[model samples]
Target: MKFTHTIKAAALVGIAGTVALMSGCAMSQSGDLNGMKGGGHEYLLTVTRPNQLHVIDTETNKIVRSCDVPGTFGQGTVEPSPDGRIAYVGTNKWEDVVGFDITNCDIVFSAKQSYDNVTVKSFVSLAVSRDGKELYTVQNPTRKLNDRYEVMEPQLAVYDTSAGLNAKPIRTFPVDRQITKIMAMDTGEVILAGNDVQAINPENGDIRILTLLQNWKRGDSWTQPDAFAMHTLGEQADEFILPYFTIKWNGDPGDMEKAEFWWGMSRVDLKTGEVEQGEILPFEFIVFNFITDPTDSNILYGAFNTLSKHDIREKKTLAVHNMEHTYYDLNMTQNRTIYVGGTSSDISIHDPDTLEKIGSIKLPGDQSTSAMRIAFLK
Candidate 1:
């Protein structure tokens, strides 16, 4: 039977109410079920305002559990362990990293980045190793003096995940400024996105530029590309992809009216350690974030005020669906269902083929720049 939009909305409300009522139940009940081996379920992980880490079961479109996280929430960036058991979050106003055991909602690991009169902040930079043994974040510190504020050089802080509670950086290395995203590759190399896409050796602090983004010499007709790397949604596709924008002079370089805006993507393969980037499409609309299809690398989905599907090789957009509001993050499950969340409490789900909104998962409060990530539980 075909259900109307009104009917589906009503049914979703009913399910949400039931889940809310079940919220008071013991955590162990759901923990035991999620802890079972070979469960093979995909769960959505995100944080909402007022300090909450929500785990939504994708199959039922219901939030199974909302765990309480320590410290205040700010730029809520969550990095789930490779095993999907622990979630490392950047909270406490971006001054600390806290790892929560999703199975029991226990605070397993915590690292305070700031100490003394020096204030440190990691803006959306958090990543866990594939083996789940090491956690990495780039910390920008500023020392407040009696009369002046001194800005210190940024450093990459590495923490051992097993260092439960009050974890400190086991090793620190200097890195470039403006790095907002970090990802651990299978080869034990860490990738940083900022002024340029760079790969750094975590063991020795050696760094090499994989792609020249802001400093790219794409001829005199093209301006410097601008891109921001905030969301970590590469796990599903096993590749870290970032979209960038640049303007090209159509005719005379001195003429401003003939400028053509373009959008491109810089990608790093997590498995093969290969780096490649190129223009995907001429700018038609704005996209806050993008996620590549797990099954097909050529296909891409973008989210913001609209949901768009694109073919990178063809440099064409296959479909575009206008959204009700803006979303800052985009992710997909193994089944290819696209999930868009940010700037609101609800996570909107869409059909991969039609690009149509199929369902929505309502959260407890506003997401407020939080990252929405997918994790598989087994």
Candidate 2:
């Protein structure tokens, strides 16, 4: 339980820039994104402020490419294409979405579409479905609702990318009701969670509710109002949850016990709108993205914003990666762990299984990008 802030300035990047995995040698510089994959892996990363995207070779953990986004990152969202060949970013900079071909490291398309009303404020969230046919962006941006505090509720806009580049959103809705997680079923039913599996048909604005638990406990039983957060997962059956993971002070239960929180990670079923059956994490986790076990409902993996794992059958949290502000996104397969999108100018590395800080990652510049959208190219 000790804290040290010795390293100062951008030079910190050089420290964690060295990475060595079971696959090969690791070395990465700034403007590079290293995605996790089997054998050989790489990622084209986009970051906020000073606007740019970096391509990192996972095998070498080194930057192979860096591209300028002009004045974009603050307002645009970047998402990888279905095939992993292209990166798509949508920005309010104008009324268009820019598509970058990662293989060549350049912009290929600037698809333009018109909207009657525009906030013009850049805060955004990007999401790509399992099949990559449906793309979603938070039109209102993920900001603090309290203007005085930085909280906000952004609208979810669904787009049909399977069609033309200018294809429009087939659905748009807010997630605040009984729903805690919202994702597409690819079957025209939107998944939501809360007291039940709620589905909203964007076309007619009709409602469908599926009960996940007959004797469901109220949200207040385990969650606080301010702890509001949500996400969508698993297209096969459509699953979601209201996240309730956080650090609890070490002490005996009772008045002496104290707990403070800032995040939660939950997933819901798009088909049933019911929160899929699963055990809640023993501790709270604040992750931007989490992957569900494609085969089982209990096995779940996500970044606690510091790397984490959980087992539904045992109802336990596997202590892995003691990353302090170094978690971003996660990808899971069978029993493999793949993490991506992290920022901490200084070097930060931990065991993928224990989460112990094995070392740190130092970036080349202070220009660290916060990933707004991401996905494994399957």
Candidate 3:
């Protein structure tokens, strides 16, 4: 079940014209010196159908700007620059990277990964450097031959953010397969999640597994861990955390019913490059993504069919509130207001302590698995 958008020539021309007109208006507004000041407000960045990047002010829970992003909307994986001025999104059926100036909706940087006979697609693997000077993506390529498709090796492509309009990878290195998410750490390492959690140095391409998921070893009684994370929301907690489920035998090794299903969390500290893993829950439930509280690292929140809060250190569920709909991604503001998004147009807000529904911000179209990211404007 791949999400894609068909491109048409007439629609492309119309979109280009609309962007040009918007750029003119932006320039006119920029000329007013009184309009250029910082409010130090926080905004949520998300993309919706038909190629639109929506920015909502967390304070007002209103759509402040809807930027025109070139290319067809696919995964809509977005990563805001460190300064929060530019937003880079995965679009064009997941084959291109487009960066938009959120203030004016101008296409500042563009990179098409697919060309010629090889079709390259990036599945939710996007990140930006701490200094906002570099961008990273894991490109999975396949060659279309006359007979069949040849699967090629995946590569981690790095791009200079200053490369305007038409951009290409300044450097690319071979990476492991099945990578769905990549995040830049303050320690200058990019953490990748796939079969296993890995940290790769962008400078020399030195890669190492920070934590094992598929290749985990917990004696012969425990089964291999199964985990998947697609959304990038760990910036608030400053740690990339992934939840995994595994089975451990409680009684007889050959007994089927005596198996204990366990849920665990694997965390990588973005600040110190430290790795840790431990059991969070003794049972399993549906949880698409989890976010840790920046002020309280022991507290974590998860989103799916229900919103849940957990105290990982104490190994207890603090709260669980059933949601009206499924939300694939979860994020939090500096003040601890919870926001769950993805799989729909509306981002539901909740109280962090009680998991009570407080407010919601509705977009113009369905998010369709787009990543929900928080950006602070100072």
Provide backbone clash counts, one per model. Answer: 0, 50, 0
Error of 1 at 103 (Å): 1.4
Q: How would the candidate models be sorted by lDDT, starting from the highest?
A: 1, 3, 2
Model 3: per-residue lDDT, tens digit, 1-378?
A: 122233466578668856654564464346431232235457789999977999887888888889877778889899988766678999999999988766666677789999899999999999998888899999999999999999999999999987766689999999999998888988888999999999999998999989888887777788888886777768777678888887888777657699888788888888898998877876657888888988998888988999999888888788999999888988998899999998988999999989999999989999989998887654
- Go through the candidates in order and give the C-alpha RMSD of each one to the true structure: 11.3, 13.6, 5.9
lDDT of each: 0.86, 0.46, 0.84
- Model 2 lDDT, full chain set: 0.46
The best candidate in terms of lDDT: 1
Q: TM-score: which is higher, 2 or 3?
A: 3
Ranking by TM-score: 1, 3, 2
Misplaced by over 4 Å in model 1 are 1-40, 254-256
Candidate 2 lowest-lDDT run of ten: 20-29
Instruction: For candidate 3, list the clashing residue pairs, or say none.
Output: none
* Candidate 3 Cα lDDT to native: 0.84
Q: If both were scored by lDDT, which would come out higher, candidate 1 or candidate 2?
A: 1
